[model samples]
Target: MKPKELTRAIVQAFIIIVLLIGLYQVVLSIQSVLSYILIAAVVSLVGRPIAQLLKRIKFGNTLSSVTTIAILMTTFFGIVSLLLPVIFEQAKNLSLLNVNAFEATATKLMNELSIYLLDYGVDLQSWVDRSLAEVDYSFLPDTINTVLNGLSGFTIGVFSVIFISFFFLRDSGLLERMVMVFVADKNIKRVEKSIFSIKNLLSRYFIGLLVQITVLFIVYTLVLLIFGIPNAVTIALVCALLNIIPFLGPIIGTVLIVFLTMTSNLDASFASVTLPKTIYVLIGFTIGQLIDNFLTQPYVFSTSVKSHPLEIFIIILVGGLLFGPLGMIIAVPLYTALKVIFKEFYAHNKIVKALTKNI
Candidate 1:
């Protein structure tokens, strides 16, 4: 290539690279704002049906929107209020925990296991002692302070989400109008159709998720109570909430349940009291998960989102690979939105047609 031509190409490439880097930095700066907007969008979508029902009953748009937001706020705070006391009490107990007593119990359990495993030449009690000796209790206070410090930011985010959600609920087509600003006039009708379809599907999908959590919460609570576990309701709520993250969530929840169950009765005999209780609790957790997997998940993925189970699984897996848990949580809704857009704008593509056929 000529020197001048090569120089010009290099300058152009440099400019493009600079522009892309600037754009990325801009996105990083405003990510919190973007998160608030996105969360508000989900809230608005979930409350869409309630607003519509109020409208059908002759309520004005503003009144319906306000009422819907009020309901959502009440429900959110109600759950928080119910759980906060239990959480704080548990935290207090943890802060006042008798570390020596806990260590003694643990050592006793380890000794039992060591005796059982003596045939294999494993020194379990020594290992447990070393692990316990290395633990630092000082971090707990700092962690609590960190959480307290974050409450201010959390409050700001909550207010921002509510402000955005109020506008979204009041103006049902606001998001559609925002999207239309970027589309060509010729494609306006198609874009509108896609937005409408996406909203309808996502509304149902989000509601289905709520139902799934509620079902799991009830089942878990029943199981914990039947097993006479301490703070059963609080534990159940935490476990149920974790299921919001797709495939990996239930496994984590199961581990958490088993750990908490065993720890709650740490002073008891490992082979008799603690171990048997943990096993029973695990059985209950398994039954709850079976109901969720077989009944709740299928309806949410298939009926609400109109996506095949295998397709949803693949998308969630890819999402997790790319962005971890947050991606997996949003994978289905984002994929559903893309499917609608593809069906509308790229109907001629055989792949798009097949993937979006149900929609």
Candidate 2:
């Protein structure tokens, strides 16, 4: 190529690269805004059915949207209010905790475990000592401070999400219109169909998740109460919330419940009271999980989302690998959306056709 032509091409490429880099930096700077938008979109999708129901009863568009938002806010704050007192009480208990007593209790338990495991040649004491030596408690104060500092941002984000969700609910097609701006005229209709399908499927999927959490919460609370665990309701809520993360969530929730249960009555005799109670609580948790796996999950995954169980498992694993817990939480909905889009644009592809057949 001529020198001048080569020079011009290099300049053009440099400008394009510079523009892309600037866009990336801008996106990074505005990431919080993007998060608010994504969250608001989910909120709107979840509330869409309520808004539609209100509209069917002759409510004005604005009135339906306002009422839906009010209902959602009330429910959210109601749960928060119920949880806050328990949380504060727990925090106060932590602040006033007798560290030496806790340590002694832990040591006693470890000793008993070591005695039981001695026959198997497992030296838990040495392992525990090494683990304790490596532990870092210095992050506690900094973590607390960070949480306190982030409160203001969290408040702003909540308000922003509510504001955006109201508009989204009031104008059901607003997101579609925004998306249409970037689509070619020829593809606009296909994109519209895809959006509509995604909205419906995702709305049901999210609602199904809410139902699943509610069921699990009820079961967990009953079990905890039956076992007379301290802060049973709060602990149950936390565990139930964790179940939103698919396969890994239940295991984490079980471990958390067991830990909390054991710690709650540390003064009691381990062999007689603590161990038996922990075992009972663990059994209850297993029952709750059985109900969830056999009943709640099938309806949610097969009926609401219309995805195969194996497909979901693989996607969630991949998502967890790529982006951790948040990815697992969102993987199904994102996958559902992509499948819809692909089916619209690539109906002839065998894999796309197979994946999207249920939709």
Candidate 3:
């Protein structure tokens, strides 16, 4: 290469490296604020359609933004209000169990399993018992207090999210203008198109999230009711909400439902049964999960993110491997955003072309 060309190449490389380093430092410094910002952005995305509807009706942008936020807050607090009673009742019932039926069920199951496993030379029951014996069971109070203390911070973050999102929604052109300031004039239109695509996709994704949760909650509740579980509504609501977290969340929620079912009798109004209704609970969960896996997930993924189910599966698996549960939860929306951007800016790149062809 000519000396002049080599010097220019080196300068460009140095500039790119420095920019990357500065970006990393800024991200690190604003990590806490970044979360709130992301939350606000999502809020803005979800509220966009409503804001647009109001705008079409001749409502001012600021008024529509506040109204949308008000609706969102009301729905959030309404659900929280409903959950608190169920939680309090669960705690009360647990405290009242002097000789818990759940413990009896566990001991009985273990004894039977121990006898069955003895033939295989694998003592699963004893191992479980030993593990349980080692658990502390004492820090629970301190943990509760710590969570209570953190409520203030959580409240602050909530307010921050609402505050930022209001501005985001009120000024629909604000984000576009802000992004354009950093874009070259030649690429500004492309960036604007990409931003529009992202907003539309994310809006559908989050709105579909609410629809998914509601459908699952109702289905789960009805299934549990058929099995004679007294706290069907509570369990179903929690499990449905947890489905928002993706794969791990559903599994954890199902396990929790099973445990709760194992503690209580199937007959809420009749004579108390000695044994836990494990079999019925298992059946209900199996059917409920099948409905979730086969029905709800396909519709939501296909319609919301506009991606194939298999593609979403691969992305989520990669996310889980790279960053665990949190990564898996965010995998779809994050991938969709990146794909949009890449389609706009790197359309010539073969891999980007392949990945974004469907989008």
Candidate 4:
């Protein structure tokens, strides 16, 4: 390569590396506040419709925004109030567990597994011994402490979300108008239409999520109860809510429910219960998943956002690759907004035409 060309390439590479490092540091600095900001954004989007309705009815913007915040807070705490007692009771159950018996049972199971694997020429016992020898039991206590501390830290973030959401909801209309000023005078109406469409679409998307969660909770609770799973309420609540995360969520939820079913409340009723409780648990979850996949998701993605299922799936995968789980969670809404903006500004570009064709 020529000297000048090499030097220019080197400078560009150096700039890119510095920019990436700076971005990483910025992310680390804002990690705590990012959660609050995301909460505010979601609340503002969901409350936008109700605030508009209030405006139509002649409610003052400040009063309507405050009322919307109150509604969101009350709904959040109402769910928390129901869930907290269940969590506390389960913690009490954990504290009362017989540790020695638990250890003995685990050891016995490991031995039996070792014996079974002997027929296949695998020495599971040796592997278990090696793994146990290297295991750090102290990590368990440290992990528990970290989780408790993290939970306590969120108290401040919760209040921050509410306070931030109020300003966002109150001035949301003004902000929308302000944004339109950046567009050419002739194209301002196009930007306004795009913004209005985004708000309406996102509102439906969020309302659809609440409906999905409620439906899943009811279905999961009923299924677990029929199988006599202990802590069905808490498990159902957790499993249902986990569906909020994209792609990987339902798998995590199902695995957790299966583990709880296998470990809790063993007896003749469990053993002679027609089918193994584990199998029953799987069956129940499979049915619930079918409902979610066939009914809930289609309504949320297709009807609410007007995106094809395959399109939504690909967007989620790309988002997960780029930005991790949070990226996947927000992928639909972000993609929708981008599509609208592109259609508004780049209507003549071929790629833009293809991407925003639906919108």
Candidate 5:
């Protein structure tokens, strides 16, 4: 083949490969719509035992699941409502963060530094005022509107989740029975083991994540409150909830809290006031993470999932990239299912060993 022709062929192959990968990703995104239902089913299975226990005590599964969901909805919506007032107050206060306040704080800081240090000729106040004035605040409203719309859409999904969860809770036994029907009697043991593995692993992962978030929430809340931070509860709750997403969440939370503290305490200036806020965030996250990795996760998840740290990290990254935050949350459970499937498949194949060597 001519060099140009060969190069053209190679380029065509690369483009085809890229297009195939992109198509696969699009399919995965479409699949995520049903993945949400799958997650609700998993959650229902996990909580079905509790529902059944409640049933034995005279509560119907529908009533028990409704009660559980109601409590969950109330807690989540209550927190959101409580925090929104404070957040809106802070957001509206944004309009009040005029150039005058910026200049005043900058002037105060420069004056303080000038008294002790060599003369710094920089006009910090002018610089700050000019920067604040030039800031494009036009997009802020649109950004907030987009976020509100997304949240409204999420509420619609929550209704579907609750609807699906009700049936799974009420007829959870049917789930296993249905699966069993597809398996021959001889394969029943293997299928049962795989199912149990999924249940145990998913339950442990969810419970572990919940415990970690709760611990972090308490730690951050106490630290923020001790430092006299306004809206401490809201900030801490947000930070801790973010911790559920592993590495990326705490970083976003820290930036948010720091900006909030800086804005709320301009009189104190950033340097002097920022220390407590930064320190509290660092300490709370560090301690909470230590407890999760060393004490909680080992007790709850390590044995059940039996996944390596690197594997978990990769799975989380893939999940996040493929399906956004929801994917990240479900990554571990899905990985656990895959792990069980691989183990079962290998065991099944071993039973059908070749009668002769490859020759």
Candidate 6:
């Protein structure tokens, strides 16, 4: 290739890379605003049907939205009020446990394991020592405190979401008309179809989530109570809420539940040691999650959004890397929107149609 052509191509690639990096930085900077928009979308999708139901019951659209918001607000506050004290107490005890005993035990175990591995010629001691040297053991307390401080902000966001959802629920007609006018003017059928697909996907996903959350809450409460765990009700409620986040949710929930159960009984505090307790927790979570993945979401959201597990995982990882926990939460819905748009493009593309015919 000519030097001028090659130089032009090189400059183009450089410009693209710089632009992408700048775009990513901007995304991260405005992530909190993006998070609120995502939360509002999900809430609006979930509450739309209820608002319609209220309208059918003779309420005006504004009144219906108000009623729906009121129900959600009441339910949320009621659950929070009941569970707050127990959760706070458990969190305090868990923190104290970490400082007083757990950290020492963990350090001792690591040292013993390192020694054992060195005897076996594994050379694991150096790795362990390096890792320990780099870690800030004191960071846990600060992390927990930071998360606790953020709860008030989270609550305020919840209110913001509800307020935004009200506009969506009450003024949906105007919004639809505006969208239709814009799309019709541009003659963009694909965009229209993609939007509808995303709306349906989000609506179905939220409904499935509600059903799964309710079932899991019941199951968790019963199982924990049967296992003689203290504060089972509060723990179960917390677990249900946490489980809304997908994969990592269960790990955090399990750790918190197990820690609470351990402290609830000095005798059965053999949580980390007892085979029965560990197995029970594993088996219960496995069954519950299996039911949710296989039955609930599939049946409810089958027509809405369909993507492979690997794709979903990638989206989640990217989202979290860009936006943290909130990104992880909205990854599925965003992916669903992408999937719908791509599918429509595939369906209409002449090349794709020819390839399908050949296959």
Instruction: State every prediction's TM-score relative to the real structure.
Output: 0.81, 0.81, 0.81, 0.79, 0.72, 0.73
Q: Write the per-residue lDDT of candidate 5 for residues 216-294, one digit (tens) a residue.
A: 7888788778777788888888888877776678677778777776666655546666656666656766776677667
Which stretches in model 1 have alpha-carbon errors above 4 Å? 1-29, 56-59, 88-102, 126-152, 230-234, 259-271
Q: Extract clashing residue pairs from model 5.
A: none
Error of 1 at 79 (Å): 0.9
Clashes of 3: 0
Error of 4 at 327 (Å): 2.1
Error of model 5, residue 353, in angstroms = 16
**Candidate 2 ranges with C-alpha deviation above 4 Å:** 1-31, 56-59, 88-106, 136-153, 230-234, 263-267
Per-residue lDDT of candidate 1, residues 184-253 (tens digit): 9999989888988988899889888989999999999999999888889988988899999997899999
lDDT against the true structure, each candidate: 0.87, 0.87, 0.80, 0.81, 0.73, 0.73
Indicate the residue-level lDDT of 156 in model 5. Answer: 75
lDDT per residue, candidate 3, 278-306, as tens digits?
Answer: 56666677776788778878888888888
Candidate 2 lDDT by residue in tens digits, 70-124: 9999988886777676657556656776778777876887788899998899988
The whole-model C-alpha lDDT of candidate 1 against the native structure comes to 0.87
Name the lDDT value of residue 65 in candidate 6: 90
Model 2: pairs clashing at backbone N, Cα or C within 3 Å: none
> What tens-digit string does per-residue lDDT give for candidate 4 at 135-250?
98989988999999978887788888888888889998655665766878898788888988888888888888889999999999998898877778878988898998986889
Q: How far does residue 256 in candidate 1 sit from its true spot (Å)? A: 4.5
Angstrom error at residue 270, model 4 = 7.6
Give residue 138's lDDT in candidate 1 (0 to 100).
Answer: 100
List candidate 4 segments past 4 Å from native: 1-35, 49-60, 95-103, 136-149, 181-186, 266-275
For candidate 3, give the lDDT: 0.80
CA displacement after TM-score superposition, residue 162 of candidate 1 (Å): 0.7
